[model samples]
Target: MRHYYIYLLKPEIASNYFGKEWLIYQLFVEGETAKKDLRTIAQKQINYISGTIPTLQIKKNLDKALRIRNDFYVLKEHYYIDIKALESKAVLKDHGNMLTISASGSYQAETVFFEVLRQINPAFFAMDFENRNYGWLNPVKQVNYI
Candidate 1:
């Protein structure tokens, strides 16, 4: 299931990634949420599935060292859509570029996701998952048997 997030961004940043015409609107919606990070999640899943990270060939330990230049959980609308679809008169109907672009809280959401892809290490993500899921590490509570 895809989760949608609506966020507001500065007009300046919005114009940078989108365009001047898209500046009027401040609300942006997108489905780009991952636990810890997409890279980490992907890495862990890949390792668990393959029992190794050689196929992924990503740095399993140097993830944090590789800083996230853009954002960790940012959103972008144009990722799944193409320019042709945006410019199609029939597709857009009577609307102008108004529906074409909405300002995300950050301009480099896609960039960040891509960067994470490059920096993710499977060994790091695929660790001790039996006791913990995405949200938090749930330590086994001792009952202190009498």
Candidate 2:
């Protein structure tokens, strides 16, 4: 089976465009064959999923995320999985991986949920006392990269 890497938009960046509930983005094949480069593969996947962005306002938000000029910001993390594994998990659909738990109902959800436990807020939150440990107290912005 072919090996692949699925890159997901960071939750913070995605929240700006999609909102809090959205998590996984799509599947991107790891290697190059023929003339298709990795960047080309990424762009193709992005264009395919672009359909999910309906409103001009949301599109503008997505564009803002892209403008950061960091591939790390745009597509922050990746998962390495084999084709057979993905197929068995039922996440492989129409050449893309359906990333959400409701969409896939598979192991991907477990992976994401586990990561959320470690995530800290990007900015300070004055409303909650828990903020003392996560947001401002933590000098480094915590994001899900696992």
Candidate 3:
């Protein structure tokens, strides 16, 4: 249930939901990983709050800490996933609670899906897990997803 704040990547001038016109904020992102200092990752990057870079470490760093190792879910054995198709319908939210999980055997598919959502051009389109869900914001009267 531990959480860390992570931001999404978007071009400059785009609006973020963290109440700031700029796109940098430490919102709740769930993960099992922890570090002695959070500043190291920030140091490696030019600036999470100032650059146009997509704040990639949100996933990259999480992936590193998760240590997927030899458990890549096999996808389709021979046929690979059509990433473009999956990404076509998803929309990345400005702020979200990202959760990283480790599974094995039959649960591998679930892990892949989580990682996939974190990737793609826009992160996530729409999803609901437990009570924590996505695609709902105060400014918008209704929740919409592509």
Clashes of each: 0, 0, 2
- Model 3: per-residue Cα lDDT over 11-78, one tens digit each: 33123442342212222212212253555564444234333323355445434534453322122211
Better of 2 and 3 by TM-score: 3
lDDT of 2: 0.29
Q: Write the per-residue lDDT of candidate 1 for residues 20-47, one digit (tens) a residue.
A: 3222121110111344566465544332
- Better by lDDT, candidate 3 or 2: 3
TM-score of 1: 0.16
TM-score top scorer: 3
Per-residue lDDT of model 2, residues 16-132, tens digit only: 433222222222222223246766876665544433312233224334433443221222322221224443221111223222211233444323322331232222111111221
TM-score, cand. 3 vs. native:
0.21
Point out where model 1 deviates above 4 Å. Answer: 1-65, 68-104, 118-146
- Count backbone overlaps in model 2: 0
In candidate 3, what residue range of length 10 has the lowest lDDT sum? 73-82
lDDT of 2 at 78: 24
Residue pairs in clash, model 1: none
TM-scores, one per candidate: 0.16, 0.19, 0.21
